[model samples]
Target: MVEHSGGHVVPFTLVASAAQAGQRTDRFLADAIGTASRSRVKALMQAGSVRRNGTVLRDAADPVRPGQCYSVEFPPAVAARPQGEAIALSILHEDDSLIVLDKPPGLVVHPAPGNQAGTLVNALIGHCGDDLPGIGGERRPGIVHRLDKDTSGLMVVAKTEAALAALSADFAARRIERSYLGLCWGMLTPAAGAIEGAIGRDPRDRKRMAVVARGGKPALTHYRTLEILHGAVSLVACRLATGRTHQIRVHLSHQGHPLLGDPVYLRRVPGPARLLDDATRRAALDFPRQALHAQSLGFTHPATGAFIRFSSEPPADFHALKAQITANSGSA
Candidate 1:
């Protein structure tokens, strides 16, 4: 959702009052007019969006002491040429505290590098308005967890402070369960297994994440083969025991079965497995991104303490890819 136009992101100011006492700068701004997420606020600050008495401010946790005047400005929506397209959203369930959405592939969970506008965050701002709390900062107001840009499926957005706090804690403690469906390069022989590794920045390529021994965080993924694919590929279901950056991708690739269109990890596909009909291969070779989906999300509601689960079918592209593979060789 990153808008590249020479658009103007507007700025606004807030005068501290008694009602806003003890609130952090990020939270106050999120609840203010235009309803931005905490992550958005962080982006604004990172993009030099906030100023305290004409001085640029950076940290979200910076105390909004009483009687201080703060100025915040966002790139105006209009200037970014942002059009509110009526995108259909699949709502699994809803309540005062949270929402579970079946996010589509290519829709980023929240704004980040190369994506700023037209994101789930911006759409939430348009839909939820002032309901989202300031947790992760302006750009990420209600987001408790994230799905990669090309991944599709269920994700939760918090609408209140209590929900935000509770959901955050659940994720931090690994109490919330998330599952995904992925198409990998080849059949996984054992069909059921666990991937345990430490992931960190690739010293050779900073843009990619790799299984590293040093300076990496522990990541665990448990996966089972849901179905065999054309004697070569496999449909796999994965569950996270520890959520780290690209945990599932790293784990699956480490097992020698990179996702079908995963550019970063599985760069070299063996000859026979490249199902593209020469011409189609040339076209698909230029396909923009990878294939991954966030198909399931489950957690205990922070406010109600009820176990909730949501699932979404893979998007059209995912189906199309599978269909192509099926045409190459009958289903397994």
Candidate 2:
């Protein structure tokens, strides 16, 4: 491996130690690089940026042999405080301490590669003016938690350092309450149950998350079937006891009922039409993204010492799909 110097992110040259040898490329990079996470390494690999002895590495699972030299190129990190964009925000509640947003689909929570501008953070920076810079670091501003780019939901943004610290503690302590609505591919036995699993990067596909029996962080999802769509699909309400990346998706997919329209965790139903009605089938097949939405959020106010709660309904596409599902099911 080539020797270089600097604490900042730059091209990295690393060798596979005996312990790292035979480890997956993504896993090895995550541990050896010290700065990148496994998911970030996977993104680098998927972007065709990681190379082994000058050869581009295509597979995240490519095993690194002992003494193998690999070079990885990472773009210089963007300076904090990306220019603010005047994107409209859906405000649920706002106060001096914090602001709650009913986040809409397609709005990224933060700036990242391929989405360096026009993120929720950018919008907040514009809306909050100078106050945001002091709330969180320059990079994330007020972000306390995040919803996926396509998952519409309620999310709280801190406006002050004190609020940020308090809200962060509440989230870590599991004092924040959150619930989601999702349509899945199949019925869950017992209609209501708790799914306890550990979520980690999928060994087979580092780009996705999975329920690993070991080595993953504990995640629990309590779900109740809200509506049954002809025994083929079910609408469910999910409450998370622990927040993890893609926790609900991984847990549901582990049990063989992946979320409908979820590109990453989809498990197509094997039987006849999961949706009997023609329109419903068409809508389900053409669904744009996962049918999951954060419908409820509750937490104690950091400044007021009062409990606050907020809720949002599914978006238009979600409603359309639900209507089609009901119409197709008839009475069943």
Candidate 3:
């Protein structure tokens, strides 16, 4: 018989059994629970719900002999209700530790002055409920990183303190890899290259990000041409080594290839790239916002310590733009 001392009751569904136990406590737990922390198992022992032959056991350090049936329960998960709104989300992956969402254009990352609702944070709050980690203040509890208001793509959020710390560290250390898909004007010279510059608020236009001369944080973006549309515009993939604000936008703009429809950077449209037809040129002039989409993300799991990668297809607008490129390719 084992002791039945109980503190926090955690119910677990037993799945399998070994040869009734002749094993070291840590080894047995490791075998029983694939990759669960030993400290968590020790905590279970302290709570005393772990049992052998229907009696509570007290020592996670206790040696075990063969022929004893062992079982344990886990604490109940805290209940929190996630608000479900009409806001659609392109959820790529979700777990206890985090959630990855493919944010679309026209959605801001966080709430701010004059824009409090209809943001990704607000949508996440509605979706994650009270389970979201409350670190980045109450307004943005689980938010770990950000994308600009007009940029869209795969973004991740932490659900727990450990996950938040790990994910933040991964970003800071540049261990997390991100790839973006975008369309920019002109036939890019060199076809593929890297852009390194300092980024700060524009002195001329405070609303836009600029590659400053004296007082901006350093930014770097590496880009490769994916396709050439009508021999004029190039669909590109930009990889971020250091995620500075408006990095890809500023870098590409600095390279003299501002994204199509990017109002702030390419204030005046350059003459159509040789690939544009009259109708396509008209469409380019009326297009709004820089075409940027987060297409890929790779990072390590905070809990399991396993590497995970996710990808998303370019959004509808991106495809439409590509279609226009293909349609007018031979005409140019």
Q: Top lDDT: which candidate number?
A: 2
| Model 1 ranges with Cα > 4 A deviation | 1-88, 133-136, 271-288, 329-332
TM-score winner, 1 or 3: 3
Q: Report lDDT (CA) for all predictions.
A: 0.76, 0.86, 0.78
Error of 1 at 208 (Å): 0.8
Q: Order the numbered candidates by lDDT, best leading.
A: 2, 3, 1
Off by over 4 Å in 2: 1-79, 267-272, 329-332
Estimate, for each residue in 134-206, the C-alpha lDDT of model 3 and write its tens digit.
Answer: 6556666788899888888899998888888999999999999999998898867888988899999999989
For residue 268, what is the lDDT in candidate 1? 79
Q: What is the C-alpha RMSD of each candidate to the true structure, in Å?
A: 12.1, 7.9, 21.3
Output the TM-score of candidate 3: 0.72
* Tens-digit lDDT string for candidate 2 (1-332): 22335755557888787877788899888888887899989988888889898888969998887888888887655656766778999998998999998988889998887888889998998898977876778778888998999999899999999999999999999999999999887789889999998899999999999988788999999999999978767899999999999888889889888877888887554443544666667677668888899999999999989998999999988888877887785322
TM-scores of all candidate predictions against the true structure: 0.71, 0.76, 0.72
Best by TM-score: 2
Candidate 1 global TM-score: 0.71
